[model samples]
Target: MKVRVIDNACRDFKNIDYTEVSANKICYRWQIFLEK
Candidate 1:
C-alpha cells in the first residue's frame, strides 16, 4: 500500500513538471514575438 502511494505521488510530480515546462515554452515564444 505504501508503495502504491509513492508511485502515485511520483506520477503527479512528473505531470506537474511537464505542465510547467510547456508553460515556460509558451511564455518564451510570446516574449520573442513581442520583442519583434
Candidate 2:
C-alpha cells in the first residue's frame, strides 16, 4: 500500500512542475500519511 502511494506520487510529481511549493506539498502529504 505504501509502495503504491509512493509510486503514484512519483508519477504525479513527474507530470507537474518540480518547484519548491510542490515539493513541500508532497512532503506535507507524506507527513499526514505517516501520522495516520
TM-score of each: 0.49, 0.51
Each model's lDDT comes to 0.56, 0.70
- Number of the predicted model whose lDDT against the real structure is largest: 2
Question: Tens digits of per-residue lDDT for model 2 on 1-36?
Answer: 776776677557757877767766785687578668
RMSD of 1: 14.1
Per-residue lDDT value at 36 in model 1 = 64
Worst 10 residues of 2 by lDDT: 6-15
Clashing pairs in 1: none
